[model samples]
Target: MTVVFAALAVSRHLQDATGVSIQNLVRTLRTVRSATIRLGRHEITLALDIPAAAQAILDRLPPRGH
Candidate 1:
């Protein structure tokens, strides 16, 4: 739940900071499949099936940074 909301907030913040939009952020999300919202664990798991673009984004981001 928090991760979902945080994603939303981060999307908005990044959009504002980069002069992008929610659509662009969603487009990025679309680049991933294995990265999912795990209800039981409350974390994102990058399975082997994840898209390359998503993996690139994840790689660019710090593990636990805003």
Candidate 2:
């Protein structure tokens, strides 16, 4: 599935980009289940807020073998 590939790719990117430990990454993800915000007229919901930074890193990643 694409989901599996994305997760694996991000995991590899995280390993290459950050010194943070795998335990720490997993813990962080566990702790941040979701994030939410509200305004008087509108609301914003982020299901993956905890891993947003990691995903951002993935977004900026160059093609592999570059």
Which structure among the candidates has the greatest TM-score?
Answer: 2
Query: Model 1: what TM-score?
Result: 0.39
lDDT of 2 by residue, 11-43 (tens): 876766665555656665565567679989889
Q: After superposition, how far is residue 12 of candidate 2 from its true place, in Å?
A: 1.0
- Cα lDDT of candidate 2 equals 0.66
Candidate 2: stretches off by over 4 Å: 32-34, 37-66
- The worst-scoring run of ten residues by lDDT in candidate 1 lies at 54-63
Candidate 1: where are CA atoms >4 Å away? 1-9, 12-22, 34-48
lDDT of 1 by residue, 1-66 (tens): 999999988787666655546686568667555555678868776665656655555565445655
Global CA lDDT computed for model 1: 0.65
Q: Give candidate 2's root-mean-square deviation (CA, Å).
A: 6.9
